[model samples]
Target: MSTLSGKTALITGSVQGIGLAVAKVLAGAGARIAVHGLADAQQAEAAVSAVRSAGAPDARFFDADVRDVAKIEAMMAEVAEWGGADILVNNAGIQKTASLADADAATWDAILAVNLSAAFHTMRLGLPAMAERGFGRVINIASVHGLVGSINKAPYVASKFGLVGMSKVAALEYASAGTRETGGVTVNCIAPGWTETAIIEAQVQARAEQFGGDTEKGIADLLAEKQPSRRTSAPEEIGELALWLCHRHAHNVTGATIPVDGGWTAQ
Candidate 1:
């Protein structure tokens, strides 16, 4: 458990699900949170309140629609003015399921913009300061799709794979930026599969209903095709991994994409 006192974490898409979980845990470690996501007024304020309650010294919401470069720039500027991000989590993403033939150009563009390009923009804007400070962490929330191909998800899979490759490049670029004591800058990806987030709720619901309300069976059914562990990871579990990477000792763990897929990729 590393302390992030005086540190500021900028997590995109942090209003709910995995992103929110990351914010809460980082907040518990005394890091100020720069929460960014798309949500209504009440939900946005609630997100801020959640992190504060989780023990953040302070938390501010940034309304950045990551698909737009201009919005990301404005958001980064605001965060920079407040003291640039020490930890940048590229957790914002959008996904649409469609086969190659059915995947339209607009869908590809949107998915690529949010899932891949947003990370690039944020890192470009944030990493320099982290290098100057001699400490930085960029944790990208990629997917198992990054490691393997899946059906009816051409754009999503492409974006995740691109994200993984991009992180590797960034990691190499900044590998020697900082020293061990400074907790050197590092870029990494967490490739998660079948996590219990809203992203998979529809599948879960449909499966559960398919099995006559037998939720456990439905989950098993869903996991049958992959996920040998037959388990769905919780969002907080992913947060725990992110927190570990933020530790000073994790300075050397760059250019790595860790899988939390319950053996889905192993198959």
Candidate 2:
């Protein structure tokens, strides 16, 4: 039998990138998927279809901005029709590259709202249902910045660090219970290093423009400087780790900020 067979997973911001990768991985393991996106119904539907194609028996789309608490609550109600959530992946986040001195209030607020507050909103609404069911998995897609600082990314780092802290507390609060006995949940965060996503590509391009060099060279330089492997990570790697964490054996691994970085945090 599949590891997550019969479980229902709600993955926020799963229309693309790492979020989509996680959805595909979980669905491949035989879980029902709730593919979420901000507003693009068509994209959300496509995500649902992709999950269904990946061996999920059931898949649905949830359209709601993660930054909005009320909308998240409403989406949870809609998701309740699918028998509530057994897995919750908080992957909705935004980033802006600006040093503290250059960072504006608007940019900081936007980063915090989407990257940190959104996760909190989802957890607040989803936790009770998880606690009631006595079984749940909450995975937050954090960043290596959560453990280490990065240049021109103050807000992103702050929000991710906060997420890591929050995840640990939530994990401890629920760790004393178990699914077989009380349906208790495990909460963990995955902190990815330099990933080859659209966001990273944009950063590469921006760096290239700033230095008057090729984007490929800029990207390589970034890897050489920050990542010990001197290579960018594929989205599937994060997806695989997330899948592993959802298995029954991973129950004891909660409250941990697992780094999937290329030894970025190790250095």
Candidate 3:
């Protein structure tokens, strides 16, 4: 495990689910934490408290509606007051399950704004400082859907694919800068499979109900159909990978989209 002592990490949409899990993992490794999430002051504070309990040297929360560029910019500026984040995790996302014909334009635009465009806005603002400092980590949390398409997920797939493409471009631009003076900032994305988060739990429950309330069968059927491993990933597993990517040893790894999808994409 790499120690992130003295470093600051900023993760967006971290009040719950995978985002919160990542925050806790990074905090446990000794990083100061800046948690950004939607506008819920109580939830935001609880997130900060979790980070603190996880042993982060320092922790704070910033609430903003990431779809609003102005609000995101304001929040970033506030975080900058504490000398900017050394690691940036673009983990904020929204999902809509609808076919192309069934999906409305408003939902598509909303998904894109939150899932794809917000990452772009944050990266544009956050990467400069990392480049100047010469050491940074930018991890975008994409999904298996980014690599392969799925039914009823047109908008989500589109946004994630765009995110992956954007990550590669940023990686190429910054690939040569991580030297002794420059802190070897690496840009990468993680495409997670069906994971055991609140989101997935809700999905499973819905599927279970659809199958006459057989929860285990619903889980088994879903995993058997898609993932060869026949299991869901733990949020901490994704966080651990994110932590590894932020380590100094991973400095040489950039512009890559590593899948933690339990062989979902392997097929």
Candidate 4:
């Protein structure tokens, strides 16, 4: 039997990147999927289609901007109608690489809204349902920035660091409360190193323009300098780790932060 044969998973920011990869992995394990996107209905539908094609018993699109608390609450209500969320992947986040001196109020607010506050909104609304059902898996897609520091990414680092702390507290709250009628829940965070997603593509292109180098070479230099493998991580690597965390064997592993970076954090 599949590890998640009868489960339902909600993955935010699932239209692309790490979120999409995680959705596909969970679907492969036989979970029904609720794919979420910010405001693009078509993208959301396409994500659902991808999950279904990957062997999900069923998949549906949800339109909600994670930064909007009202929208998040409404989306969770809709998801509950479909039988509540068994797995929640808080992967919706935005990043900016500005020094604190250059960071403005608006920039800080925007980054916090999407990266930190969004996770709070989702967890606040989704946790009650999870507690009621007594079974749930919460995976927050954090970054190595959460554990360490990075240059020109103050807001991103701050938001991610806060998320890791929140995940640990949530895990402790729900870990020892399982009953026969209620299933157990596990909450964890995954900190990925630089992955070659659309976000990184944009970063690479920007760096290339700034340094007068080919984008490919710029990307390679960026990876070689920081990542021990001399390569950036793949989104699917994070997906597989997330899949493992949700399995039965992972029951005792809550409040932990797993890094999928190719030894970037090691240095």
lDDT of 3 by residue, 141-202 (tens): 99998899999899999999999999999998888776844459889999999887765776
lDDT, candidate 1, at 131: 94
| TM-score of each prediction | 0.96, 0.94, 0.96, 0.94
Clashing pairs in 3: 134-182, 134-183, 134-184, 135-183
Q: Which stretch of 10 consecutive residues in model 1 shows the poorest summed lDDT?
A: 198-207
TM-score of 4: 0.94
For model 4, how does the per-residue alpha-carbon lDDT over 1-267 read when each residue is reduced to its tens digit? 388999999999898999999999999999999999875667767888899998899998898877678888899999999988989999988887888899998888888888889888888778777777767889999999999998889999999999999999999988875543344788899999889688777678876875686887788778877788877778888888999987766777899999877898888
How many residue pairs clash in all the candidates, one count each? 0, 3, 4, 1
Model 3 regions lying over 4 Å from their true place: 180-183
RMSD (CA, Å), candidate 3 to true, equals 1.4
Alpha carbon lDDT of each predicted model: 0.94, 0.86, 0.89, 0.86
**Which candidate gets the maximum lDDT versus the true structure?**
1
lDDT tens digits by residue: candidate 1, 138-164 = 999999999999888999999999999
* lDDT tens per residue, model 2, 1-267: 387888999998888899889999999999999988875667767888888888888988888877677888899889887788889999988887978899999999899998899888888778877877777899999999999998899999999999999999899888866664434689999999988787686688876885687887788788888899887889878989999888777778899999988899998
Clashing pairs in 4: 134-183
Give residue 193's lDDT in candidate 3 (0 to 100): 91
- In candidate 2, what residue range of length 10 has the lowest lDDT sum? 175-184
Model 2 pairs whose backbones collide: 134-183, 134-184, 135-183
